[model samples]
Target: MLNLAPELAERGIAINAIAPGGTATDMAAEHTASYTPPALRDVPPEPVIQSMNALGRLAEPDEIATVTAFLLSSDASYITGATIDAAGGWI
Candidate 1:
């Protein structure tokens, strides 16, 4: 995105990305149950999350959606060539 942003900006286009940390999604739920090690999987997500990020919990889908909305809105017109960290202050 950083590379293409300047060129896209010439056409009045914006390119950005979101780096989201752990979140409660179907994919995550499924993966956590099957893929995560048994020891870690059985341990409630709260402590694990606390170790990974400040929020200490998974993000709701709407939390991510709100960031998307803001980026797409006119309020963010000046933002480009950037990655928004919608990770609830994950380190």
Candidate 2:
């Protein structure tokens, strides 16, 4: 999606994709029951856990908000078609 930024800018249309890593939002907590531990793995990874991220912690909603604010403002006028990573190193 980010590769298309230059194209969008050429036509004067701003477009971007928000790539958020592991966030501690409500939706993530509800998906934990879907996994079952396989013997090869011994135990299931952290249940309802977003700990695999580089931060080893859940991301606050405010972090996403800040990215959103930046994306929507005039200050980001030149940042079209960019994928803003709001995740805490979940990538």
Candidate 3:
């Protein structure tokens, strides 16, 4: 994305990336159930997962999509060659 953004910007194109952290989704639920670390194995998933981020909770799907929408909209016309951290302050 970094390499292509500059070249694409010359043609009036905007390119960016969204790096989302843990989100409360079906896929996340399944992954957590199967892959939780041993230290957190016995603990309840909600609190343990929420505590992984500074925001104390996972992000909503729309929250991440909103950032993508903005980048695609004229509101972010000046934004390019960047990665938006939509991670809810994941640690």
Structural similarity to truth (TM-score) of each candidate: 0.90, 0.67, 0.85
lDDT of model 1 at position 30: 89
Give the per-residue lDDT of model 2 (tens digit) for 27-55. 76555434544542455445434456766
User: Higher-lDDT candidate among 1 and 2?
Assistant: 1
lDDT of 1 by residue, 1-91 (tens): 7999999999999999999888889998988788788777667777777888887788999899999999999999999999999887888
Candidate 1, residue 43: Cα displacement in angstroms equals: 2.3
Model 3 lDDT-worst window of ten: 41-50
Cα lDDT tens digits for candidate 3, 1-91 = 9899989999998888889988889998888878877887788766866678888888989998898889888899899999999887888
| Model 3 TM-score relative to the real fold | 0.85
Find the candidate with the highest TM-score and give its number.
1
The local lDDT score (0 to 100) that residue 62 gets in candidate 2 is 88
The lDDT for every candidate, in the order shown, is 0.88, 0.71, 0.86
Residue 52 in model 1: shift from native, Å? Answer: 1.2
> Superposing all C-alpha atoms, what RMSD in Å does each candidate have to the true structure?
1.3, 4.1, 2.1
Worst 10 residues of 1 by lDDT: 38-47
Which pairs clash (backbone N, Cα, C closer than 3 Å) in model 2?
A: 21-87
- Weakest 10 consecutive residues, lDDT, candidate 2? 32-41
